[model samples]
Target: MIDVAEHLAAVLEAARPLPAESHDVAAARGRVLRHPVRAAVDVPAFDSSAMDGFALRFADVTAVPATFRVVADLPAGTDLDPTLDTAEAARIMTGAPVPTDATAVVPFEDTERGLAGGLDPVTVVAAPRAPGAHIRRRGSDVSAGDLVVDAGVRLTAAWIGAIAASGVGTVSVSRTARVAVVSTGSELVSPGAPMRRGQIPESNSVLLAGLAEESGAEIVLRTSVPDEGDGPRRAIAAAEEAGADVVVFSGGVSAGAYEVVKNTLGDLMRFDRVRMQPGKPQGFGVTPRGTLLFGLPGNPVSAAVSFELFVRPALRALEGDAEVGRTSTRVALAGGWRARPEKTQYVPVSLDRTDPAAWVARPTERGPRGLGAADGLAVLPPRESDVAPDELVTVALW
Candidate 1:
């Protein structure tokens, strides 16, 4: 009969971060970083060109129509150090290193060619140029030994690019935790299988598998077992043998005759039927094989809610992510609501913030919420008689 917060805290206290592993940057996307991503070397490494132009001394362009002799042509990646001393310019392309004596860069489009392309101080159209123009200063983007990206950041495409640019060919990232999903029920039939009377389609396994995959977990196994002792036991053993860090089961946690999941788990797990509607029959603990185990209710909405409130946070904690749980917000109830108040209720709700200062939320049935028809879940307090309009209520943001 504990509040949701107390239950959540207990679950969190029992969880710990997963072990780290080395992985390629390409494969590390969406995975949490175990270590700091400091710069191995300065960005740009050395002074290079910011534009394609001729490198010349600023003093040479003091008067109008003044041009310098083209000494040599420098393209990208050229290491030759040609000095520009007396009214001389070096033909430089983009990303080329500037000469030592050069103070400014005159774009080739602003001047005419020297006589016969020989050593001649030709005329320039523009006046005096500024020193260091079109020059990319060394380490302007990043200084040497700078902490480019910090630890605990979720590796992304931008992070990968930064790491590669910082000379990190390989990276050490947290290994994706492996998860095993098992859906149990005697009346469930797999997709593409023939359906029989009094049977429903098997979807919890797919849903659980998709959720695990989206949460940066590698699926070691995805299976379905009948509402029987032997089948569920076999599935549990298979999951443990796959080296899964977490094993999830949908259905058979409630008080039902076919609740083989609860009976088979025996003393290996702890059931927590919180005083919350829509997801009351939720359970989690360690499996017989020492891996984390969670038994979610069979109802689609119930299972989804259980995953959000319990399993999602645990996964995030193991991955070292700070934003581990569903964010909650306060919204004004658009209409009045009355329900049996002894138990906390989770009502599917749609939110609208057309007026930035206030948000309006309206509750609806389960199916509407599944289609993203609701932006959040309205949390009704336990033992409240009625909730009136304009009253602020807590909502779990999607």
Candidate 2:
């Protein structure tokens, strides 16, 4: 049997970062940026008023009740640069461009007439605290040629807004991965189908498809085929025709007599028994066309755990993300149980995070109360002895 970490290393080695392509910032949301986004122009582009008030030279406002001749009326979005003489001012609205000679702004409420102040004579009842007060100077938020967003970072809502304000209309981002999910087993039938004594519902496709999408991959194809005939090969052909970059197959990599996936793709992929309980049988390979292939266990819990340990990180790396592994944290066990001998055991657990500094992981029993109720898995190391209560171990949160 192969070590789990060795198998993971092999999977990641086969995954490559997709080529970068230009995309509109709106279309690039949730994609990893391939290049740094530098501001082409200042955020504000020009000096503007932050309040509806008088835009005048500060030298004319050191004393209260200073009188001035309002020379111009500037509203938001107007580009007029009116000239001002000594003791002259402009009646400016919020977001309007200030005159070139203006050094400060005092709100209309600070003036005797307040909003009644017109584009003419007005008296200031209060003085501005300092020069350039209430003014959003050019480049104050972002300057030209500033790095607004760094490379390899995923674009979220906040990042999208920053890109929009950075004067960059288009950005380079990693290409989205097209994934296909195929589940192999003759006894498996679709949910709600009439099932005989030996038949079971085919649910691995749904599980793998959702996990693939959550990792930033687009599901290009999904199919379920039996162990007999050419069904598995046909499904893979369809996936390739649909431009799939990865194909995940479940239930046919084990040492069963009728292992369809292992038999059909044996020439391209290599099957391995990883030293991990419940999901040890694994298969992985890159096809001639460079599409990755993965084979997982049939059991739902095993399939999910295998995906979390191997597939998720590969998918993330394909999108150029630097951090690809699940976020693992050390937590103390609320209670302990005997561990599987000589095999890495992943036990479903519910974490008590109320005491954040001292998180306690409670192991749930296998079956209905196990994986379904778990938000994480406490990764118990390979050992034959029973784990003691309050022992510290690493847990990978979903």
Candidate 3:
């Protein structure tokens, strides 16, 4: 038997980041960058108007009730560069390039006529705007060749937009891991199928596949095999042929009789009883072809817990993520619960956010109902039999 930390460390030690590949920036969300992304061009490449207004020298509008001649009309995307002199203004739309001599912009609302009819000589009803007002200066947000995003950043929608604004069309990011989920059991049947007295609908594949996908892994193959004959080996071979980087097997890892995974790949894998509740039985090893293998318990909750505690971090490590673990925070317990002695317990819990700074965790309803309502798992350390109300506990958020 090994401790949870030891097992996790072993798993991480065996996993390495996948090779970097160039991908379109539009499709790189949820992927980690292998190298820093530098801006190819400055944001707001040229000085532009931030609002639809009149562009003129601030000196010309220092006094209210002043009149200025409209020299030209500048709309967005115009290439013509008009110059502004004293008492002269240009009707400029938002995002239009500002004139070289213009030092201020007065919004249409601050002037007479408001450009409602047409660009004509307008009277300034408000005081002059400070110099350089309402102008988005060139390279203000990001200069050309500046670091737009650092390496190991998990690309999000905002990051993609920033990259695009910096004139980056493509990015080099860590490749997503290819995963294969194999559920083993002869008595297992697919969902929505008729079941006999001893047969049950298989759900570990769907559960594991969804979890894997959430962790940024691409599911290449998902299949179920019986416990008898060469079913398990055949499925593993199919996974290898499909170019999988990792193969996850659900069930048949315990000391029970007729354990298919233990019987088939026992020699090739290292099985261990981790000191954790719900998911104590675990197995992991790397194949000769360099594909990682994981054998998780069959029970739905146990399988999900094992995936979060072990497989998810490994997947993240393979993608070169700096933060590979679930987010956790300390919260007060709303109720009391019994914990297993000498073994860690991961109890499902729901949060009370009436006070965000002091969140309270209440144990969720037991059985399958609990799984649905749980927002996080309250981690109970070993040797703590009972918890009191309002006790502080660390919760790993989903």
Candidate 4:
């Protein structure tokens, strides 16, 4: 038997970050970058107009009802940088670069006799609203050579948008983990399949596959094998051939005489009692092909908790992410239950998020139905037995 932390440390040590590769920024969302993304050009590129108005010197519009000659038309994407003299204005559209020496932009509504053409004369009805009122300065948002996105960042929509705005087309990121899940049991049958008196529906592979995909992994294989002959060995061989970096096997790891997974992989894996209720048995090792192996208990609740605690961190670490563990927030207990002696307890719970500031948690209504109701897991420390209501505890929100 071992404490949970010791087992987790071993798993993390084996699950080093995968090699980094270059990917186009458009396809890199949710991937962790291995190199910093520096801006290729300045944001805004040059001083541009922020409004569709006339671009003129502020000194020319200081007086009321000022008249000016519209010298040139400057629409967005124009190559002309027409210089404006005193009292001379240009008809400019939004996003057009401001003419050199121009300091303000007044909307068409702010002027009387608005220009029907670039050469038409117009009268300004209002004074310019201070210099540089509606001009976006060059390099104002970001400068060339600036680090827009740092290394080890998980690219999100905003990050990708920033990358695109920086004119960077590609980024270096860690390759995503490829996972395979296998469920082992002689009495288990596929869901919706005809079952005998002793046979039960298999569901661990589906559960693990969903969990792995939720963590940003690509599921390469999902299979089930009975605890006899060479099924376990053959499944592992198939996973290796499929290029899986991690293989998670469910069941057949306890001390039972017919523990197929442990019996077959005992020379390669190290099985132990992990001192956690409902999930005491744990087995982990590296395969000959270098794929990390994790053997979890078959119970649905135990498998879910084990995956969240140990396997999820390994998956994140494989992506070079610094944050590899679940974040638990403190919440008030709405109900209490007895904790196991000398072993930490992870009770499935439902959270009352009625108030954003004050969250309340209570144990889900017991049984499979209650387990289905759970959206969180309340963590109670070891030796803390017989908890009372209204007490404070930390919960990991799903």
Candidate 5:
């Protein structure tokens, strides 16, 4: 038997970041950047207008009810450059390049015509208070060769927009970890299929594959095999041939006579009983070909908990993420319950958000019904007896 912390530490130490790969910026969302992304060109490559209005010298609009000759009309994406002089203006649209000598912009709302009619003889009723108003200066947001985003950043929508704004069409990101999910049990059948007397719907593969993708791992293969002879071994070989970086087996890891995973792969992997509730039997090892393997418990809740605690972090590490664990918060317990002695327990909980600053955790059962309503897992340390209400506990948000 080993402590939970010790097992996690070992797993993280064994996992290393995969090699970097280049990907299109459009397909780079949710991937960790392996190298810093530098701006290829200055943002707003040229001085542009921030509003649709008249672009003229500030002196022309310093006085109210002033008239100026409209020199030219500048719409967006136009390449013509018309200079603005005293008592002269240009009808400019939003995102249009600002002409040289233009110090201010007066919106059409301040004029009587208001872009509804001809602009040869435009009237400026209000004066722009200061110079350089309503102008988005060139290179103001980002300059050429500037560090747009640093390495190890998880790409989000905003990050993608920034990268595109920098004129970068492609980016270097960490390779997605290829994963294979193998659910072992002879009595399991696929959903929507006819079930026999001792058959149950196989759901662990779906659960594990979803969790793997959420951690940024790409699902390369997902299959279920029986506990009979050579079934588990053949499934593992198929995964290895598919170029999987990690193979996760959801059952046959416990101490039982018909434990296919234990009886077959026990010599190649290290199986340990971590001091944790619902997911104590855990196994992990690297094959001779350097592919990682994880053997989790059979129960649905136990498999989910084991993936969250052990497999998720390993996948994150493989993707070069600096922060791998789920976000945790200290909250007040809404009720009391008995806890197992000398074992840490991860109890499903629903948060009472009426008072956000003082969140209350309502415990739920260890079944699928409770899991459906749970927003997080309450991490309860080993205790001699039952815990009381109002006690503070750390809850790891999913």
Candidate 6:
């Protein structure tokens, strides 16, 4: 039997990222980028007004009570000729293009309406204002040919806004991998259903499905099987028929009298009893239809932890993400603890960083077999026992 870390390496080594597919920028949120995204054109595109004010020459005004005749009115998206001189002031609205020779903008509220008698009323206002105060310079935000986003970055809301503002209406991202989840147990009943004596509700299927989704895999099929070998085999057959790249089964892989999943899949799939606690029993092999199959433990906590520490990374690898693996951190044990020398122990523990550089690890009351209500798993090294308080221990973070 291999160690926990070595087992994970073997599983991750078997997966690969899916191919890239073109999708609309609006629909690509949360998906991984498959190619670099370059700016389509100048972000600002043209020199325009940033405020609803009068566009005029910076040198035209001397002091307060300075006046200029409004030559032309320009609203947003309006195109104007570049023929304005120092004597000309254009009435520009916000987002409107600035006419040539304009260096400042005087807001309309700053000026008062002049006499409306027979002449074109000249608005009186203060001037000799600061340059570039209200003008949005062309290419100020981004140039015409700048790279906006690079490949391997996950698309976020801000990225969507940036790509759209850069004139990119579509984006290319990695396609999501399709997955199927199957649960096997005769003692399990659906939630809210009346249970017989000694029966438990089914939960591993839903948990695995959620885990798969978090790892960027799409769940296309979900089903449950009885604790009979024929029932589990039928579920696997159905999962393959649904065209799943990966098929996950829960609850029938452990060592027990009624381990139907192991018995059924062992004939058509490879079975391996791992050396880790809570999830020591496991199996994996290719389905008859060529889909990857994983038989997870039956206990809720064991199944959940095993998927996070093992199966989730494989799904991430199949989604074009390079950072695909469990993250481990060194933590100081809060209390003294001991473990067996041969079997790898996954103890549930709560961690805190009271000091910036040190992590405090507090072991939970739950044992390795009792993982359903655990906070997270702590990897106990196989070479030692009786870890002291404040001793450094490596733990896998969720």
Models 1 onward score TM values of 0.82, 0.87, 0.94, 0.91, 0.92, 0.78
lDDT of each: 0.78, 0.90, 0.90, 0.89, 0.89, 0.77
Model 6, 9: alpha-carbon shift in Å? 2.6
Best by TM-score: 3
lDDT of 4: 0.89
TM-score: model 4 vs. ground truth: 0.91
lDDT of 1 by residue, 1-398 (tens): 56678777866776677878887777777888878877778788777777766788888788868757778888898998897778788888888888888877776566676323444455667753477877787788887688877877788899998987887766666667789999998899888889889998888888878878877789999988888657767877888888888888999898988887887886777777788888888777876455788899998778877777778887777787767867799999888678657778787888887998998988766552452476778888876568887688999987
Off by over 4 Å in 1: 62-65, 106-130, 326-365, 372-398
lDDT per residue as tens, model 2, 1-398: 99999999999999998899999998889999989999999978899999999999999989988999998899998979998899999999999998999999989989988768577688999999999999999999999999999988889989999999888899999999999999999999999999999998888899899989988899999999889877777888899999998999998889988899998888888999999977999999998989899999888889988988899888888988877877899999887767777789888899998997999999887863487789798898888788889989899988
Error of 4 at 233 (Å): 2.1
> Model 5 scores what on Cα lDDT?
0.89
User: Where in model 5 is the C-alpha error above 4 Å?
Assistant: 339-341, 354-359, 383-387, 390-392
lDDT of 3 at 183: 94
The clash count for each model shown is 3, 0, 0, 0, 0, 1
Worst 10 residues of 4 by lDDT: 113-122
For model 5, name the residue pairs that clash.
none
Ranking by TM-score: 3, 5, 4, 2, 1, 6
RMSD (Å) per prediction: 4.1, 3.0, 1.8, 2.4, 2.2, 4.8
Global lDDT of model 3: 0.90
In angstroms, the error of model 5 at 136 is 1.0
